[model samples]
Target: MKDLKGKVALITGGTKGIGYGVAEALLRQGLKVVITSRDENAANEAADSLASKTNSKGAVIGVQADVRRLDSQKEAVNQALSTFGQLDIVIANAGLGHFGSIEELTVEQWNDVIDTNLSGVFNSIKASVDALKESKGYYITISSLAGTNFFAGGSAYNASKFGVTGFTQAVMLDLRQYGVKVSTIMPGSVSTHFNGNEPSDKGAWKIQIEDMGELVVDLLKMNPRTLPSKIEIRPTTPPSK
Candidate 1:
């Protein structure tokens, strides 16, 4: 991490939003990057766009992977290793939310939220832990403030993020002895397409995707002895309630 140049990173759900932003930041820092999306076309398009925008010292590639399936995640890790020869960072950024009162939430909706937001994080780490250990690398998961706070209609989203927060903390303990660092980032609100929201000028008050990207870069560059295991970020201000 001292040089960052030429290090390799594998990011889940990197076609857009936070994942895409993080990929761009890492590329600018001279780290080769592999971004995955369930949609092959989106993944390739995003990679091409990022390559065109950044005068990166490193390179970027796109892969088709689904975090919900362990095999898919494993394939992504393999692709990264085959393409870049090493994997130094893994970001579990793919996530989704389904909000509704418990009574109104369907079984399918609950499954979708848990599968993509919680189980997905597990799959990402499980797939890349060995590569990380080999490189003495870093693993980061994108959680949310809802992980610690709860609301009436946020049962599914809350449960998944809460799981992510706890899981990442425990994984940190498990991996630190091997010289791998683990951390989870929890953000209150961001300008992204999550839950069908559009990113636009109206959301200027919210945390920008680039802000999250910067945080990840900071974490990766932090001194090896220091670990900021859990971080919670929120907008500086919000409109009057």
Candidate 2:
């Protein structure tokens, strides 16, 4: 089993949804968790809630960082190293989605999604690679099934997710020789605050947030020699048509 006690993990966009869930699981495993959100207040609330439930305030630190900005990512890493002294895991879960016909998708909208979902991952890995190298750490990206399946109005979102999966796989190869394990998790129709949809909305009919959290916990416990590079999680049952 992968030993997580005494480990340190940095989760981006961790104020809610899958990101927050992953942080909660890591904290419960006794790993020092540093979570980042664009909003300082939200970050504080999430950190406090996780720490309170885990009964380990010292092990949970919250930082405010815009995933789209490299400078913000730098601050996040600095805060993590300062608070935890090292880093062992990174979950690049920060992303955005905008759906529209390719012709209707404005250039600005396309840029926004690509910058936050793809370039943001690059910035995150660059900032944290050294620490990961030092720790033989693991890196996981919260990609999407949209990366593979394309829909008519999903031009921007599909391209963005496609870039994410490809980028994650390439980085995994680049870092594997350095003892770092990289993986991308793709979930289908998860009920979360992804895109503009509130997780608690009435239309929510898919996998629960906590189930993905449990999946992350399970991944953490997998053997080191085995790296499940690509994980696709979908609901066992879908809504009736």
Candidate 3:
């Protein structure tokens, strides 16, 4: 909390979207970042791009990991420590969405959403808890407004995000005593290439990835006595019906 410079952060699903934005923001703040993705090529490419964008050499590391697997999360944590020598922040940003009515949703798809969006966070925190405890670090999760708002086709996605919101709040209570901060950032309608959509100026009305990145930085800068356990951010204006 005292300083972010020279701090190390490990972000899952950081090759693109919100995760990528956060990596860029932190790197600009002089933090070493470890970005993880399921694809080795994508992870490496993202790390390289982040370094280039920030004009920071070797400050961004890439680890190929699938958040669904606890071992993969642990490997990412190990890589962050091995490469950067210490970890002060962990971002559980890996997530997936499978939208369908309860009747139309398959068991496999349901499991995928729950595992990646909910359990993935638990695994990431578990892997980094020891290091975070030692460093008095921060744990952040990128949730969604859908966590609290339910829609007809969002059965699986809603359940997962709702679980994340509740889980993160409980974790905040559990970890605050150790000086490790925990928070969940829930954004509504971000203009990222999430699901199958592309990010373009056409969707500019939605929240920008960079905006979310800045929010992360703001949370990191807060005084240790204050913890915003859950944050819900929405566009100031929405498209008319």
Candidate 4:
């Protein structure tokens, strides 16, 4: 961690949004990255774009994998090991939201949200825990402010994120003995395409994807003796309601 050069990271749902941004940041820091997406084209395209935009000192490759399935996650970890020779970081950043009152929420929506947000984190960790233990690496999960704060119509998302926050903290305790670090980032009002919203200038006041990327880099560079287990980030300012 102190010396990040050539370290390997496996990021789930890295084709765009926070995952893509973090990949770019790690590449800029001279780390090799494996970014996964369920879509093959998006994954490859993102890898190519990141590689082209950053200096060649750090390498990046994209693989197709779904965090919801343990087998798929295992394949992604295997791909990272085969290509980069080691896995030092794991970022579970894949998630989705479906907002509605519980009375109107569909079983399908609830399943999708829980499967991708909660179980997905578990699959990602389960797939890479051994590799991380071997490397004594870091595992970071992208939860949400919703994890801690609840609102009407946020039942499914709130449940999943709350689970993620608690799950990650417990994992930190479980993994620390092995020298693997674990942390979760919960952010509010980020400018990205989440839940069908598009990113544009209007969202300039929101937390930017690059900001999340920077935070992840800082976590990676921190002293090994210190661990910031849970972090909540929000925009410095927002329009007056």
Candidate 5:
């Protein structure tokens, strides 16, 4: 925690949402960042933009990774390790949602949500375990309040996020002995294009993307002895009511 200048962070699904916001904050803090996107073009674009803004020597690198696959996650780690040597933080942020009634939700839809939201986190941690251990760094999972608050149409998303919360807690205990801190951030209603929707000005009432970015940085600055294992965030005011 002495300096973030030379530290490296690997963030998944870092294009146009909370992940990108975190990348921007880390870059501004002078940290080297590797941002992954499922699409190569988007990843490269984000990396270049970050590099220009950060102006650190070789500050940003991007890789195409699909978090649902272990091989893709391993490849992302290899890219980070080969380019940056050590990983100081790993953010498991890639996720998707498909809303429907339990009776109406298709098998394919359920698997898609679970694979990306839950299995993706598993892949990310498994991939970076060694590098993070060597650096004694941080591991953060971007979960959702859906993990705790389940609604009628959120069956798939709720199940996956709930599992993510449970898994992250158990993994925290396992990694704590190795000096790695694991935590989960559960934001209630973020204004992001989580389900392939476009974010508009009307979304302003929800939590802003930069808020979670600030939260991540704050967590990093906290004392190492104190681990904020689970954080629940909600919008201060809801829909002017």
Candidate 6:
């Protein structure tokens, strides 16, 4: 495994779910973590909880910022740099989903999905690209299977995730020359509190948050010469509907 001691990472939408899981995984690898949430209290609380869980005091910090705004993203990145003194990794994990038929989907819902899932990623990468370039770091985004397989009532969500997958690929090409690695992980049916649904025993067959966390750590440990530009992950045994 790559020695990540003293490395620093900034994760967006990190107060809970997959983001929080990844933060814990990185912290275990001795990486300083900065997590962001749109809610200040949630961000701070999650950070504190993660620090306690990981037994890595002073290794985690929280920043309140919304990914939809470039300024907010920039502030989060700046906080990571100022706090940790360097930014080695950026996980653009902030996202949302609004599933509905085209006609049934409200404009606000479409925009929310687009802005958070697609534009939010763009804003995140733009804000952190310079710092990542300086550190020759890694940039990873959390996309979804909807990006590749369209389903009914998934118009806006599919569009946004498709955009994320494509945008991340293009960025990998653009940033590779700078020695900065970029990749996108597209997961299917993760068991998280996403889209206002609570994760329960019934969803146990789906991919768990810790699975994604381990995937991120594995990516970070991969040989620098080899970059897995795109990864698709699914549960080994998804329940039949």
* Number of the predicted model whose lDDT against the real structure is largest: 4
Full-model lDDT, candidate 2: 0.87
- Residue lDDT tens for model 1, 129-217: 99999999999999999999999999999999999999999999999999999999999999999889999999999999899889999
Clashing pairs in 5: none
TM-score of each: 0.98, 0.95, 0.98, 0.98, 0.96, 0.98
lDDT of 3 at 203: 90
lDDT per model vs. reference:
0.94, 0.87, 0.93, 0.95, 0.91, 0.94
For candidate 4, the TM-score is 0.98
Where does candidate 3 stray beyond 4 Å? none
lDDT, candidate 6, equals 0.94
| Candidate 5 TM-score to native | 0.96
Q: Between the candidate structures 2 and 5, which one is better when assessed by lDDT?
A: 5
Clashes of 4: 0
Off by over 4 Å in 1: none
Candidate 4 residues lying further than 4 Å off, grouped into runs, are: none
Which pairs of residues collide in candidate 4?
none
lDDT tens per residue, model 6, 52-101? 99999999999999999999999999999989899999999999888878
Q: What's the distance in Å from true for residue 181, model 2? A: 0.2
- Candidate 2 C-alpha lDDT tens digits along 1-241: 3778999899999988888888888887888998998889999999999989889878898899988888889889988988889989999998888788888889999999999988899989988898899989999998899999888999888888888899999999999999899999999988877767776655456877778888888887898888999998887768788
lDDT of 5 by residue, 129-238 (tens): 99899999999999999998889999899999999999999999999999999999999889888777678888887888888888998998888989999999999888
For candidate 3, give the lDDT of residue 200: 90
Better of 2 and 6 by lDDT: 6
